[model samples]
Target: MGRRPVHVVGRVIVGLLALALTGCAAPAAPADSALSLGSTAAAAPVALTASATAAARTAKIYSIRTTDATKGVITVIGTLSPAPKTGTRIPLHQWIPSARRWQEVAHGYSSGTSVTIKTVQPGSVRTYRIAVGPQAPYAAAISPMISFKHYVWRGIFKKGLLATGGNATPQFNIVPPKEGPRRAEADLLADKGGYVWGEVNSTGCSFVRNWLGNLTDGTVRTSLHNGRRR
Candidate 1:
């Protein structure tokens, strides 16, 4: 009757209070669980860092000049400031007549602030440039392009070439350097851009051919009328 209703109401109130107590007691895990995940660990902020400065940079190069000497040799002279670091090598580039671009040929370390570079004189008139490579804070710099050419050995084919033949047509030939991706006759022509280190002379008695065979030791031998002539 009336007691039963009151008892039921009392039980309902106790259940509601127990539910509120459990809700407050339990801790939230969504935020904390997310932070503990492996993916979140990778996004952590980096720690701050600091240190002191080091010696001031002091590297510079100036003025490049090339001179042609006897026996196909060229001397390159230049100056550097603050002395170069040991193992610092300077680069020399030569212009490719066909490609119309520059390519590095040789490199060497400097001798104190003044640099003396010796290179085989170019076989033909060519252009050269000195490049100072970039070092950390410094940017790369290049020297004024210098042109080098040897005085043409003057002669009117004085000991000239005359083709010889019996009852047939004569033959003439021109040879070029051996090593390259492609062989070209551009250097063998007799035009303004050509070079000659030897000439041919022939008469009806027989056929005589003279040509320059560059030896490994920088000395050239000429095959004359009879045999090998220096």
Candidate 2:
């Protein structure tokens, strides 16, 4: 081969130096505990930071989450530590400002460590609580009231978050359920497990069927109505 020119050699050296510099300056990838040598994950249970004050409550209620799946239909869930015994009858209560008492709105049974309660919550924001029965060996307990506000979608700056088929609807409502002095002092949210219970007051829950959109196109809408407490 012919002898390389001095400029060509200089260019090659510069390129090599640039490559080395880039290698040194590149950011390290985040540690993948599954593949990293020194990365480790917690092997023990984590402590919860709930702030519930009740003698009957041996644990804390981390937080409450609400989801609006269909219009006027809402699913309420809560997490708590020291799960309740299965088959325990609990009464879900709603605050009655007029009567100055917590009225039973719905009822649910404990299956696991958490409670899943469904309600048609479309009216003005209302507060809810779960009352655990203290029958026999169990002491009567009440979960911190979680006041859920009705879900409303804001189109401002939120129009571009969804694709044509992508639903930009609310994934979950970011509000607590408790209200007033009996409410949880701090918002202790649990990503996994914490302390929570749920109940319902028979004849206290309500729902309404509503029809919304109708067009030649395949699109549909709903003008659903929520529950009413008497």
Candidate 3:
């Protein structure tokens, strides 16, 4: 081939060099797009953590009450708002007058949102509440305080004919079924000349007891039997 012009050769060489440089130097991604990608990746874990914390904070304790006052028994209940991923532990707190602070008395674990805990009867009156410890997506919570006392049954007496000889009927202060038939002590009074008979009902007893009394010439006679005595 005939020798090419210097200018033409120079132009071809420059064009080839320009093409190579363009291929080697690829276009860079937009600054905004690159920065946005990095930011999204970095915030993913934080967003998840915040969501978990919020879910845990929403959990709460709602209600607690005395189920069996006479037995010193109590029931504690609560709701887990959105519910937790796993079971949660519940603890019972009692106010100690001597200590002047709350003390943990009992604890239990639950799997569902609705929880119920029953406590064994205590020896004395006590103020109590229920608490739930942190369970990841379920936060810690506490219930309202409740007080319980041993139940007592009193007698209601009806007397007829005050002098000479008379009859008296007695009713007991009892919440049927719950309190049921119980053992009790009562003071019987017989003035002048008359007969007194009454039934006593109380807690911690399975059977009922009745008493009968007779008075004459300023003397009193007492007896106890399944049926009325004369």
Provide the overall lDDT of each model, using Cα atoms, as 2-decimal numbers. 0.51, 0.47, 0.57
* Model 3 spans with C-alpha error above 4 angstroms: 1-49, 57-62, 85-87, 121-127, 144-181, 185-230
Off by over 4 Å in 2: 1-56, 59-66, 152-230
- lDDT for model 3, please: 0.57
TM-score-superior candidate, 1 or 3: 3
Candidate 1's C-alpha runs over 4 A off are 1-70, 152-230
Q: CA lDDT of 143 in candidate 3? A: 65
- lDDT score of residue 69 within candidate 2: 32
Residues 90-162 of candidate 3: C-alpha lDDT, one tens digit per residue:
7778899998999987766666676666776555577877666776656676766777563323221212212
Best candidate, TM-score-wise? 3
Each candidate structure's TM-score, on Cα atoms with residue i matched to residue i, is 0.38, 0.37, 0.45
Query: Can you give the lDDT of residue 115 in candidate 1?
Result: 63
For candidate 2, write residues 1-230 as lDDT tens digits: 35568778999999999999888765554454435544333422221212122334442234544465333455555543456778666566778888988877666566766666666554457787776665433466677767766653221112221211113332222223233221112221223222222121223223322222233234333222222346
Q: Residue 38, candidate 1: how far off, in angstroms?
A: 36
Judging by lDDT, tell me the better candidate of 2 and 3.
3
For model 1 the local lDDT of residue 180 reads: 23
